[model samples]
Target chain A: MNEIMSILSYTFFQRALLCGIAISFSAALIGVILTLKNYSMIGHGLGEVGFAAIALALALNLPTYAVSIPIVIIAAIAIMIISQKKGEGADLIIALVASGALALGVIITAFTSGFGTDAYNYMFGSILTIGSADVILSIALTVISVGTYAFFYNRLFLVTFDESYAKARGIRVTLYQFLIALITALVVVIGMRMMGTLLISSLIIFPAIIAKRHTNSFKGMVFTSVFVSIACFIIGMFSAYFLNLPTGAGIVLIYMILSALSLATTKLLKL
Target chain B: MSLLEIKKLNVSYSNHYALEDIDLKIDEGEYVCLVGENGSGKSTLVKTIVGLKKQDSGTINLNIELGKVSYLAQFNLKDLNFPATAKEIIMTGTQKHGKLPFYSKKDKEVYKRVIEQLHIEDLQNRRIGDLSGGQKQRVLIARALISEPELLILDEPTAGLDYNITQEFYKILKQLNKENKLTIIMATHDIEELANDKPRIVYLSKKVVYDGNYDGWKGYEK
Candidate 1:
């Protein structure tokens, strides 16, 4: 109990809690849409691009989020464009891009002699390392994300369900598609600080899948996903502080356990 | 004035022409059925009209307001697993009604009317994926109708339905056309079943072979 109180008193722990909650909520909102559209893998692919950007930023002594965010946005748009072209396999294209970015990141890290500690921190994530700048940026982005989602909720629902019909109804399908990709890219980049590049995409995938197993409506799925993500993040952070486990892996393992329980319960109930 | 006009329209799929020199005009409240064999471009023509497919060289003049058009795509079994309720799916149709981020009171009224019109009140709260094929088709039709579109385009809406369900489906469409005067342009292969309506039939095999009453299509040959 004393240890818990002392941990909570630290500014780093408070920042991690705030950032983790915000990121998890933002990721849940974007994740439900992507998972339903069958574009969940794009999160993983864009995370790789963010990883490359972060490595490059570190090697050049530049601000990490400043460099990584813009590059991830560009890569996200590129993926959307490439996927939109007919007759081209979107999954294959995403795979090639993801692998290429991972290799680039690895090669850059190799050249930087003193990159071991920074690279390790990025790959596994350290909640104690989150700075005030990250906290402010994360909170601002979360607000924008929530606002965009609220304003475009109906239109996004239409596009996700029947894009062709949405187009016929004059919904500007392309614009909304790019908007979703952009929002997802932003969330993935900001989230990489605490979740790590290796497992960040899981935050986007697990919550949606677990909620989908329980909810039948789009609104229900989204609400359930956000709730599940926030709960998992808080519990994972606390468990990591007490158990001395890596924060990212701790959160992801909790997500896995929750997802397994959700799956089993859904099957038992025949839902 | 015609509600929709397409002139000199051409659509191709990688150097192979799917439709060429297609000219079509549909007036308000007209019931037009497009019939053709597989690869005859029946689907292509409807898709082009709905703005899902770009025309190679032509003009598609929609006389009505832009949002006054609605489409019901062909059913694919893969979409059966979509996590949405019938009511939620139907509510999406109201997106064309206004610029608001959410549905208004009027939108909700229209939704209620659509549910009653389609006799899908029981399925309103049911998950779409859990509904039967016939029930799902009615939900989709409701989605298309809730927009109150002057022109409703359907691409093989009854493709995989059973015989009785197909009959029921046609009945609802006929009621909408005759009673509500909703202009409907449908593409389907069920010519004999649709013979009772005496709808204008456009038979195509890469081009319009016949564009007249259904009885006239019997003599049409590619």
Candidate 2:
């Protein structure tokens, strides 16, 4: 208990903890919406885009956040436009765009910055060096994301269920869709710092899947996902501290394992 | 004057014309049944009328505006696994024009009335995914009624149901049509089933083959 308190009292550890919680809360909320809308793959693409933009910033020695904002938003808009075209095939487009962007980022890094140990850490995630600025950004983005969701809850629900029905009833399906995509891009941007590019999408998908297995209503699913995500973050971070494992990977693995167990529990109880 | 007009409408899918130069006009309160065989453009015409697919070159003028339509698309058209209750699903019909984040009491009352009218009050709490096929169709119909739409469009409203349940649904539809004087346009393949009622009938197979009395159209099909 004394050791745990000592770790918690450190400023860097406190910032890392706050950043992790904020990322988890926002990702789980948006993730439930994405899972319900059947757009889970978009998160994968957006996270990679944000990751690549950061890599480009690092390689060019520019402010990473400055270069990242426009690139991630553009990527989100481009994916939305591509998905709109008939036969564009969302899964293939996202996969191709993400892998291609990530590859370009790596090639640039190799040429400009040389192979470095920190690059691999960034690829996975390192909570050890997360600053207070990162924590504040995460909190601000999470608040904005969750606030938007609260205000547009019903509109989003209607649009996700039936686009034509929503349109007929005079709901702006396109507007809601764009709003959702925009928030998702923001979440991906902030989440990349805590979960890294590779495991970040899992932060958006796993808890939502667990929540879905237990609940039958949209509200129930969202709240359950948020709760599970927060719990996983705390447990995973503490366990990683003691086990000398990677913090982000530990959190992701904890989420995945608990999600599996939740699924099993729901089945056992026939929920 | 017609309440809705479709003049020289043409709908194509990747170079194949699904509906060709089709002209249609429906007056207010007319119960029109669109009949045809499979791949005969009946579904395409219905879809075009509902604005799901835009016509390549045509004009669709509606006196009641497009927002007033309540469409019950083909069963296969909806994603059944969607996470919502039957009542919640039905409530979406009213929420489009509703005030944000809350449903009005009048809207709630209308929903209640529709559920009672369609005998689906028991299924209000059930997930739409959990309902049987016939029950799902009934809930969809309830949803269409909740909005008190000026025009109700149904695309195969009775697909994947036993004969008794289909007839029961139409009987309920008939009651609502008479009580509310709601305009209805339905497309169905079961010509033998709806042959008795003399609703306006439009037969289309990529073109307007016939448009006149319903009873006379049945002879052409035979």
Candidate 3:
């Protein structure tokens, strides 16, 4: 207990906790929509695109987010366009793009000097290095994401469930789809700093699936996903601090365990 | 003026014509049934009317604005697993009213009225996935009616329903058309059962083979 308190006393740990919680909340909300649409893999694909952008930024000694955000957004739009075409599934397009981005990132890292350590930290995550600026950015992005969701909740729900019906109702299905993709891309870019490129998609997928096992309504699933994600982040952060484990992997493990518990409980209760 | 008008409309898939040179007109408060075999362009015509598909070369003139058309797509159980209550699903129909984040009192009243009208009050709070097929169809119809649309377009709504449920579903549609004077355009393959409703039939086999009452359709089919 004393050791946990001592870890919390550090400013970096405080920032990490705040950032993780905020990002998790936003990711889970986006995850519910994406997962229900069967576009969950887009999160992972965008993370890889962000990873590539981050590597390019590192090679150029530029700001990480400033470079990654715009590129990831473009990649997201490209994915949307490619997926919109007939005879091609979005998952297949996302897989192609994700593999391409991962390869590009690896190639960039191989050439960039002194990037090995930063790359390793980015991939595995080091919450100990989280700064105040990252916390502020995470909070700001979270507000944008959550606020956008709240404001357009009805439209998003309509588009996600039955886009054809939404279109006939004059809901501008394409515009809302683009908006979701943009928001998800931003969330992926911000999340990569704390959760790492390889593991960030877990933050966007696990909570929603876990909540889905227990809830029978969209609102219930969304609310429960946010709650579970925030709780998991907090507990996972504490465990990472006390157990001297990697933050991203530790949090993902916690989510896996909770997901298993949720699955079993739901089946047992027949909910 | 006709509530809906389609002239010289052509739709194709990979250069194979699905609907060719289709010309049709529907006036207000008309309960029109479009009947055809599979791949006979019944679905395509309705889809084009609702703006789901684009016409290759023609014009579709709707007297009412596009927003006033409510559509219930063909029943696909893929989205039945979506986590939404019947009430929530119905409430989304009010999205066309304004830009408010929440439904207005009038919107809520409409929702309530539709729920009552559809006799789905008991199922309002129930999850859509939990409802029986007939019950889900009622909820979807309620969703369509909540918008107070001038025209309601449904595509094979009773495709999977049993005979009793299908009859009940058609009865509700007939009531809406007669009592409320709601315009309806439905596409279905069950011409024999639907013929009893006395709806004006538009028979199509890639093109309109008959456009008249059921007796005329029977004569034309023979």
Candidate 4:
């Protein structure tokens, strides 16, 4: 018991606990917006882009997040630009570009000497190594993301419902779309540290999907998603601790289970 | 001077032309109805005018400028189950440009005026997702009008309403047009509704087949 208590008292575990909760809250709120707008894959696309840029940064041995910032931004901008006038087919282009980048990164990392074991931590996040700097970065991102969402809440709502209607009323739909993409990219970057490239989107999607079933309004959806995400993060982290399992997989599995339960409850209640 | 002028307008998807060589002019405060078969480009024209769809090759010279023309699509782009009140939907019109944390008092006043003007005061608090088809149409129209646009464009405004509701809607539109001096352009399937409001009519079937007054539509008998 003393050993377990001491482990929890360690700075690494404290950083992981704090950053994990904040990341899940921010990601889940944004996720509701993405899910409602049917842009669930945006997070996935961003995760792939983040992984590629991180791999490139590792090869160059640069500050990983700083080096990857421009790449993720470019990927996000490309996704928005390509999808502007096109239909669902644009999603295909986004997926292709993102997957190609990730695959390229994987190949590069595989060929590199030092990137062998280090790359696995990124592929599947290792929350055990979370540092104070990562925690500070996550806190900053959470503040920015949450603040921006609150500021543009109504306009975002209008754009989500109908871009044309929003434009007709002079909402600057393109500008808002660009801003959202940027923020989503930033969230993905931060979340990648805790959840990793493969599991980050689950942090965004599952909480949102479950909250959507239980909520009636956009505001309700946001609150519900944040709550679900925070709860899942705590439970998944503790469960991973007890079972000596991978934290990312544990969190995602718990999210999936919760989502399924939510769906079933909605059905039972005829919602 | 014409409120709107289109010269040699052509619309297409990929290679298939939807409208061809369409030249038309709308005067200020003129109520115009576009009657056309499906895919004949009635909705396409309105969409182009409102900047929703780009013209493949043509010029839309609006004396009123682009954003001053408000447009309502054939159907609400939002899902029917979306949780927004009628007032909130209508507010989207007036508050479009006034994004978060910057909503001015003047914008609220504009919304209040529009609510009063549209006579939807009673229905303001009702959830738009729960409204009937006719009511939804009215709410959307009210939203378009909230901006006080120089030109109001509606695509198939009464497409899904009951016969009686459609008639009543046309009457309301006629009254609103007269009272507000709103320049109204709409694509409608109900040719009979044109009889009550004697607006200028354009008959189309993949082209501008006819353009004249409602009573003098010579392309087809109503």
DockQ class, candidate 3: medium
**lDDT (10s digit) by residue, model 3, range A46-141:** 988988898999999999988998999899888887788754888999999999999999899988854577888778788866788788888987
Error of 4 at B74 (Å): 1.3
Alpha-carbon lDDT, every model:
0.86, 0.80, 0.86, 0.80
lDDT of 4 by residue, A163-185 (tens): 76877665678887887787788
Backbone N/Cα/C clashes per model: 0, 0, 1, 0
Residue A40 in model 2: lDDT: 83
RMSD per prediction, one decimal? 1.8, 2.3, 1.7, 3.4
| All candidates: DockQ | 0.59, 0.41, 0.58, 0.39
Better of 1 and 4 by DockQ: 1
Model 3 chain B worst lDDT window (10 residues):
B94-103
lDDT of 1 by residue, A202-248 (tens): 88999998998888888898899999999999999898878899899
Candidate ranking (DockQ, best to worst): 1, 3, 2, 4
lDDT of candidate 1? Answer: 0.86
Task: Write out fnat for all predictions, comma-separated.
Answer: 0.59, 0.30, 0.52, 0.38
Per-model chain B TM-scores are 0.94, 0.92, 0.95, 0.91
DockQ for model 4 equals: 0.39
Docking class of 4: acceptable
